[model samples]
Target: MSDNLAIRKIIHIDMDAFYASVEQRDNPELKGKPVAVGGSRSRGVVAAASYEARKFGIRSAMPSVTAFRKCPDIIFVKPRFEVYKEVSQIIRNIFFEYTDLVEPLSLDEAYLDVTNNKIGLPSATLIAEEIRKKIFDSTALTCSAGISINKFLAKTASDINKPNGMKLIKPEEAMAFIETLKVKDFFGVGKVTAEKMKRMGIHTGLDLKNKSLGFMTKNFGKSGSFYYNISRGIDDRPVNPNRIRKSVSIENTYDNDLSDISHIETELEKLSESLETRLAKNKIQGKTINIKIKYADFEQVTRSKTSQYWLSKSTDYQPLWKEILLDERLVQKPIRLLGLGLSNLNTEEKENQGLQLTLEF
Candidate 1:
């Protein structure tokens, strides 16, 4: 590996079972036991499961009732999001001390692009170790970090070692490392997609890499291109700061599976209506409509289509249903979750005036 390429240092940090761990950490009595954080409402879902609980078939977003059934002794704690946010900020402060190129995926996970440094550290590995030490010293929390020449491999490396650990993937070793990875270990490949690939005999990263981009694109569309690149441990995307979000979305899990198209469409309509209200609230404009669907079997599919019109107008997303057409295919499988988002961002407007808009993705 060329020493010059080392300048492109990236690190991905993820706190271990964040919500559940937080609960356990604050309440010493709960440590080393099966713990899950969420609510007991009929349709409530688990926000996080402790490592102990996870070993017993529990996981985040699993039905609360199912979680209880899986581990009857599971201690359920309500989520304290405000506290989590505070902790997240403390960790974020630590990242900014090293580099401003931090992209937070959630309260407990982030990608720090340390291509350049504030502390003049020569090795990203040293910075990662120091960050872990600071996080633990300050908040009594442990975070794992993955370091590499690019975002994809860096994120993958972070998971290689867990809970107060770090892993480094040199540029030359990235491709070989990814070649041995399971297809399921890939970022974009979820349960449903992984099963689809498995049935196609694409079990490993090398297997996925062997497929022609055209074939993968035909199957997965735009995400196919992402898969093609990441399969070879290549990710050129920058760690963008203050990126404009052109869309906002919310989703709720249902106690009952939506076997009927009417129910699924009803949920979509509600999500779309809420999204439109959010758009108006933010005074943002976007011309793309996106729908995310999760099947009862836990397979997810996202379909989006852009338009020449902005989201400020009602006519923009009304007809998007006619374009993507995944609803027609989802008729056979019951939907467990559904969400809607708008993108193809335009610059923000502070006032309540609507403008004719055109957005390109």
Candidate 2:
């Protein structure tokens, strides 16, 4: 590839039927039938399922009883987390051999940045194919690979082909490819955002690309800019090894010392735009919203809010922001550096015991 623009060579690797495949590798009879790895009927959820299980609409996280309803002949295998972890390590080690920029989303999937790799391979496609072969050779497992210029595109491309397959998205063809993609298919555009975009007639990349960036920004907050860029296949993001946000924050160092109330608002607007992008990309719901201010004299103070719901997206900030911005103490400060960070991770346990009670899924 030409080095004119320094595009990132990203590849997303996903193992096929991860847990189920491992079970089938050792069990001869389970090779061709629909298989689920999890608890048996009457309790527990399906952690993984073979392709045959997918055919019967038996999916991971479904109740064991539900899976039975989907496919009466479905076979349920207990989860062996230790074995899966060992296999995951093997694959991860192989990835490090090609590139240190490997970001694992889960045991079964990872994103690798091979722009500057250890082996100096000429093509990312070759790297992906070689990796696939190595995985199968080592574990007797089939995996899917996606090669593209950015993480988002690569992740999407990985799902296009399954069961030991590969799909490459070149820079030259990116725009045309994105034009046909559904809005929901875009990485990071979840159900809520997709529905919101749909209401605004943003059904596909082509439709999203046709809308003004300003409009998207107004409606979706900071993520709107990223969505606009991605729809046009103009993503400039790198293949980061650590994609998870430890904290989501937006800060600005103003050109001049700001004392006026309007000045603070203007800087806040810019920061809000940037902050929203980071939060949406990671899909992390934050509990605390922290505000930091540094005065001209170098004094800094931070204020935080603990929210009940995980801040799912930038839109979730609306309620929190109204409270924060209206606070008299924070608004009175002559801010030089203004920042916002979301942290305090809190997760909710599943109310429904997915598989513990039913032999479903």
Candidate 3:
């Protein structure tokens, strides 16, 4: 870990229960109540849960019925995506006031490189505080922030004191902080990966740091190198403001499994139409068409075919679906879910010219 590598000042800002918060903010009657932003229908899923709802173990992507079971008084509200998007843009404009080096992870969270800010601020902590305040003043919403030398640390730190709070990890303290952090708490380590690491006796950042690079790469494949670097407070990746969309996909989970081939084909046609609309919305074209099938028993598999010419319309890729569905493996069992996606996009190889800036503290 060289001193020069820790020169950048990064901040991660994440809104507190974004969707639910917006719903509560707009409708005061919903305030301080257990609120889940989603449908309450039989196949409904929760998109977001307010802090009040979270006390009952309500969470996003949870079944609405399960949420109701947890808290009988829970209120389910439909999502207003257009309103959320408008608020997101307002917050993005605030970030541009300080620096153009802003990378949005989603509508509610973003990574900002304020090392060399427009206002020439020397303290990243101050910048984060100011940003949080401005977001609240504009949206009547609160947010949490993390300030550190790089994106990884900043992202991890943001969750430490969440819901309208901020934390800073200075360059010198980065390694010590990470070493004591749980392996499950690491930014990219999901549930399955955490379980795998636990089985391997890698339960914490220190345990991860103790493993040889060869041992890690052997076990985790490509991501092993990333884990190795971050364990020692090393992440050189830049804050890419112009992040490209790698793929466009649409998936549907049915209330009941479909065993009939005709019914499956009809569902595939609907998915193809949705995928095409999304591609056209984003102006995306790709060479690879993919299908994902999830069986009633939870077994899932994907099939893909690549063509020399780009495909963007539903008709262009629907023919490929029939070719893929001919596989014997697909009809062996009833399918509970079907997905269609396009990848190897026209924009895949294109790179945005980014500005390089530095700060002296």
Candidate 4:
């Protein structure tokens, strides 16, 4: 490692099953029991699953119905965002006391660069321990911490021990630690990319490191270079504290594939309402509306329309959803999923006399 890299101390903090844990903490009866937060037993998706639920293959983003099938006795709890948000703020406040270079990934996870910190702690490991302890002390919740030179290694280390565990990857051990890492375990290497890597005879970080940079770029395009650098444990991405949200959206998968236009319309209405709720909560509106449809065969299509001005009303989006659905060539196909989104974000408000007419073919 270079001198600059050696001196950098990065830490990744992830709360242990945040939503479910919060529910369990607030309700003493739920302790040590399988719990899921968000969605219901009948429809929608699992937002988060407790570690207890994970034993039966339950996970976030899995359909709630599927989660039910996996763990018949699993308890489902509706999300309490107000409570989650408050806990998140408490955690964030703890992080800010350690370093200003805190980049939050979500309500439960964040990256903190402590090369230079407020408390003048020399060891990043100690800083991580202190932060984790402070989080528990403040919220009565546990978090996992990873200490390393960069975000990737720190994040990977955090997962090594989970649910109130901490792990560190020292500079001297970084190379060896990376060598044994499977390609699938690398950040940003999804199932599709892992399959592609396997087909290319790259199975481990060592295999990736052995390939020429040119060979990687030729095969994987922009991501090839990323893979190459990470295999050697070199990631220079900074902890950006000022990331902005460019869009807000909501999506759902039904218990049965929706076939008729009427059913699809009903689903769209629900999706639109959900999207509006999210937008209103975020206090944002957008000029663009996007509709996503997934067929029963897994084929998906997205259609979008950008208005001249930002719109926050569900009334403005409902007609556009109908237009997109009617205009789609695959309208006759059974729809398995529906999604609605808003982009081209605008925070400024314009006085609306009523719904302004703006639609183009």
Candidate 5:
């Protein structure tokens, strides 16, 4: 690797159960109790779970009813997006004080490039600690940070000591650390991929490193090459602050299953309007429309159609939404959730404009 690549300083910061922690911080009564942030426990999914709730095996995205079964006394609180967004800005402001090369993965996590920082700091570890301390001072919430030479290692290292902690993977130690890592811990390698790799006797990073680049590419295509490089502690991808949003989606889970066509249509219109607002807010249009339906029995189905031209109008989705909603198999069952999404996004130079604002540091 070139000296420039080997010397880059990247940091990944992740909040500690952001939503649930905010709820606990604001309401003293909720502290020390298992808290799940979302809608009613009867009809929604857990958006976030506090450390206390996680002790009971509760997790984000688990069905609320299932969570209730796991912890009968688990408290469910509705999400306050407005509040969360405000805090997100606060932390982002703090990040900008150090470097303009900050990339947000979500409201709860972001990556920072501080090789050349505003503070003239030589140690990325100190910058990470100061950021964490400032976040606590500003919001009374703790965050974990990982420091490394690239985004992948920084992200993976951030998880090593989570919930108010920090870890640094120096360039010298990167290889040995990655070598002992399990295949499942590799970024972008999900459950099915890990299982497949295991079947091929690739259970650890060492095992993956043993495979020739040609062998991995032959088996996994483009991603195979990525796996080969990252296994050897080599990742050159930049921390792109101008990353584009690939898709926009919104979904709602109803308290009561909708059995009537009229009710379903009304809900679809509301969802369509919401999707339009989101599209306009992001200043982008999409070439594909996808509709998702989850039945009361929890069986979900999705149908999609692509348009030759990009669309920004909400009404453009009505026809396709109606067609998918009225599918014979779907109409036969009571619907518990309805989702509308747009993909193959078309952006008008906004991402490029973001690039123009970049600083070398």
Candidate 6:
């Protein structure tokens, strides 16, 4: 490890079932129930599941019907995004009180670099505890926190003790902790990758660490170096406050696949309108209009067209959507999902957003 690693402090704070927790906090009747915040329709998906709901295997992004099947009495609540955003801002304000180097992963989670905090705190663990207490006092919401030398380790540590708990991985203990860590628990290693690693006898961080750099590179390409480094507890990524938004998109999966061209086109138009509203709300414009189609057989394809001028209105992309949908291959199969997105955004330009790292004792 480098000398800089020993001097840095990072914290990952994740709200406990944020959406459902908010609903439960607002309604007394939902306090201890298996509450899922989302639509209850057959095509609906769970945006978040309370801890009670999680016991029944309910999880975010799960199909509502499947969640219902898992737990017949699960209460489904509609999401109040405005309320969530308001609360998120309040939490972010609390984070800013400690450090401006806060990187929000979502409305429910963020990373904080507090090696040099506003109040001149010496321990990252205490700061995490104070933040969690303030969050509970303000929002009646519990959050879990992880403290470590780097973002990846801190993120992993946060999950160790969940639902209003905190865990710290000291600089010296990082390697030992990671050595025994499950491969699946490593950040960025998905189910498919975990299965592949298991097949290759890489079930733990130590197993991954045992592989030669050249061998890992040969198998996993560029990502092999990332895996190798992180296995040994080396993550140099800074806590970026001004993380850029890569794209703006809207997508929907229908309960029933649409075979008719007219129906598909109508849905596409609706998506385009929704995308326009979102883009207008965010004040984002892009030169590339992209469409994604997923067939009933699970095959997916994406098509994109780059325009000379920036596009933000529905009318601007409706023609491109029609042109993209005109393909015979798309019409041959019934589509289960339709998505529209804009990329190469106006905010993609480079800027001086570097962090001002300091070590204040």
Could you tell which candidate, 2 or 3, scores higher by TM-score?
Answer: 3
Residue-wise C-alpha lDDT for candidate 5, range 245-301, written one tens digit per residue? 888999999999998989988998999999999999889899898988888888888
TM-score of each: 0.73, 0.66, 0.90, 0.84, 0.93, 0.91
All candidates' lDDT scores?
0.79, 0.79, 0.89, 0.85, 0.87, 0.88
Best by lDDT: 3
**How big is the RMSD of model 1?**
8.4
Which pairs of residues have clashing backbones in candidate 1?
Answer: 146-158
Compute the lDDT for candidate 3: 0.89
Q: Give the TM-score of candidate 2.
A: 0.66
lDDT of 2 by residue, 1-361 (tens): 2233446688899999999999999898999999999757554567899999999998886767789988989988977889999999999999999988788888989988787679987688899999999999999999999998877789899989887789998877788889999999898899999999899888999999898999889998999988988887766555556555457686655545678877776677677667778776766667888878877665778888778877756567655765776777765656656787888754332222111111100
Evaluate model 2: give its lDDT.
0.79
Candidate 2: misplaced stretches above 4 Å?
Answer: 1-5, 242-361
Better of 1 and 6 by TM-score: 6
Candidate 3 lDDT tens digits, 276-306: 8899899999999999887777678999998
The whole-model C-alpha lDDT of candidate 4 against the native structure comes to: 0.85
Residue-wise C-alpha lDDT for candidate 6, range 1-361, written one tens digit per residue: 5554445789999999899999999999999999999858465678899999999999997878889999999999988999999999999999999999999999999999998889988888889989999999999899999998888899999999998888998877988999999999998888998998999999999999999899889988898998999998888888888887889999988888899999999998899899999999999999899988877676789999888989999998788878887787878988877899999999953343244353432
Candidate 1 global TM-score: 0.73
State the weakest 10-residue window (summed lDDT) of model 6.
352-361
Please write out the lDDT profile of model 1 over residues 158-250, one tens digit for every residue.
888776688998766877888999999987789999999999899999999999999999998898988888886667677765655656676
Top-down TM-score ranking:
5, 6, 3, 4, 1, 2
Give the TM-score (vs. native) of candidate 3: 0.90
Point out where model 4 deviates above 4 Å: 1-6, 252-288, 294-301, 306-322, 328-337, 344-361
Predictions: Cα RMSD each: 8.4, 17.5, 2.7, 9.4, 3.2, 2.6
How many Å off is the CA of 347 in candidate 2? 17
lDDT of 4 at 119: 89
